[model samples]
Target chain A: MTYGLFSKFPAQPGKGDDLADFLLEAAELLERDPACIQYVVSGSDEPDVVWVFEVWTDQAAHDASSEPEDIRTLIQRAMPLIAGTPEQTQLVIHGGKGLPS
Target chain B: MTYGLFSKFPAQPGKGDDLADFLLEAAELLERDPACIQYVVSGSDEPDVVWVFEVWTDQAAHDASSEPEDIRTLIQRAMPLIAGTPEQTQLVIHGGKGLPS
Candidate 1:
């Protein structure tokens, strides 16, 4: 699978929860899009952090979902909610098994 | 740039820090590897939850990193630390800006 995960901290300590909510909402929106095979958004207890994990059939599908103008808004709104910039990674996902079982 | 993000849960509570440590160590080791461009590991306030964000020059480099046996160990050791299976994702980073300040 073409998979990757990343996390971000809100610019302020208290903003984490809000940011988490925002990202979750974004996930709901993104999942509805046909290009998104699977996407999940979650928050950290830190109240200033959030995470994103996503998978796509291929790069083209992933890139297509990323082009909408609303996508930009979703991130800009999340900017201040972040402390530093988000840490991003591209993973091979070698040893993963059943999810949420 | 080719990028994606994914997160994993350790199958148990109170193991988030441990998973985070293991992942960070993995990152350190991975960063030293020739194929890796940028890899960051982080933990959530909720124990047993960890996130990974990675970037690579392309699919070949990422696939190369995914083929290691150690990668499986890095995840297997994290199993008990998680509550269940970790959710994974593939993303097209649209509005991400700077990394650490």
Candidate 2:
């Protein structure tokens, strides 16, 4: 199954540029790893916000990537840059037939 | 339960601003309604990306909102600005005790 997570970060004053750079690095790290099947990083087109769409090959892979202490710390480091608290949800990737693969 | 949708739009060079404004207006419409419990809008800190985090009161409400013709058109209009296709997943709002209400 494709495990998914949606995390949001609010705009923090002048840290917009810094936060963006930090997320780019994070996405690169995940994309470079073999376990990551579909990892997308995005933000609002107009406002100060960040959202990450993550899909791993399976539960085991998702669990492994999230278990790392470094990733945890990276999130912690990025928190303060947010204007509002982040909210997220996870799910089983049921299916997407017509959409791009 | 919170129904979510994560859509990614491939950046269309100059159309970024138009897309962002469109999304903001859409969010405002949703937020003004009572069924929407939690609605968050944010963009990537670095790239041309838009992500929305939405939590509706229930499945019925979520279904109702998306059934509208105008919303569909809005999304269709915004698609061109996306750098890539969007992806998302939904789940039951199991529970969050420690988190603020």
Candidate 3:
């Protein structure tokens, strides 16, 4: 089963770009991991908010993807730019384009 | 530039499956359209809410996709099962795996 996570980040005022850039870097880190299916970063009309949608081979793949030292460092750097706790929802992917059929 | 939409639909009690099925049907409508990049339907740990994350070649592509009669019918069918006004956020896709380089 494909596992996904949808997250909303409320960045500190004027820090949306900074936060999004950090996430793009994070996405790059996962680029080589075959178990990481999707890691999309998005910016919204709401200036202080950013969104990330990720799909993995399964829940375990997602859990292990964040264990790398570099990813941990990125998360540590990203925390200070966030205004509040990020919202996350775990997902079970039903089906879609860009996914294995 | 790629355009994206992230939506949250809260379904009436036990209507989650119905709403998700409708959205999956909706996804099928766009399968042949080259401009439709990704249309992922997801069920979450929150039993009553469904998440839809869509990416298009541009916002116009997404808008035009819903103009077809069948898609409109699906939307009409889906509306009643939803508990309230759905939340939609317009997105600017930054980049990621499974997206065009």
Candidate 4:
């Protein structure tokens, strides 16, 4: 089954662009992970918020990706710019256009 | 600029499959709209929750889509199956692989 993760990050005041840049760079790292199906980072209309939508081959793949040193470094880099704790939800994808069945 | 919408729907009790069916059908309808770039509906690990990730050509394109009779009908059909009010976030996409520049 496809594993999904949706997360919301509200940047600290005036840090939206910084947050977006961090995420876009993070996305590039994710792109090289064979298990990652889609990892889209988007800025919200609210200006201070960013959204992350991720799809992985399975829950294990997602869990394994997080253990990488590069990903951990990115997470640490983004921590200070975040306004508060992120809101995250885990999902089990039924079907989607981008996923390989 | 690309417009994005992320919504979460928690189904009432055993209505998950029913809700997923409704949204999957809705995806088919959305596919016919030229302005819709991506409309993916997926089930979650919680079983009762569903997530919708949408990307459009622009805000006006998204707004115009809501005015269509077919979309209105789909909304009406989906309203009851939803357990609570959906959490919706509007986004101004910075960049994503699937989006056309």
DockQ of each: 0.04, 0.04, 0.78, 0.49
Proportion of native contacts found in each model? 0.00, 0.00, 0.81, 0.43
Report the C-alpha lDDT of model 2 over B41-60, residue by residue, as the tens digit. Answer: 44444355555555556768
Question: How much is A58 displaced in model 4, in angstroms?
Answer: 1.1
* Per-residue lDDT value at A19 in model 4: 95
Model 3 misplaced regions, further than 4 Å: none
Query: In order, what lDDT does every prediction score?
Result: 0.55, 0.58, 0.90, 0.80
Model 4's alpha-carbon lDDT is 0.80
- Name the runs in model 2 displaced over 4 angstroms: A69-73, A97-101, B1-101
Most accurate candidate by DockQ: 3
Candidate 2 interface RMSD (Å):
15.2
Give chain A TM for each model in order: 0.71, 0.70, 0.94, 0.90
Tell me the tens digit of each residue's lDDT in model 1 across A1-101. Answer: 54444444444777766776667666666756755544545443344556665555545676677567887788788777777867754443322221211
Compare the candidates by lDDT and give the number of the best one.
Answer: 3
Q: Tens digits of per-residue lDDT for model 3 on B50-100?
A: 899999999999988988888888888888999998899899999867686
Q: Which ten residues in a row have the lowest lDDT in candidate 1 chain A?
A: A92-101
Question: What clash pairs does model 4 have?
Answer: none
Q: For candidate 4, write residues B1-101 as lDDT tens digits.
A: 78888888889888988898888787777767878877777886677788888888898988888677887888898788899988898877776433344
Between prediction 1 and prediction 3, the one with superior TM-score is 3
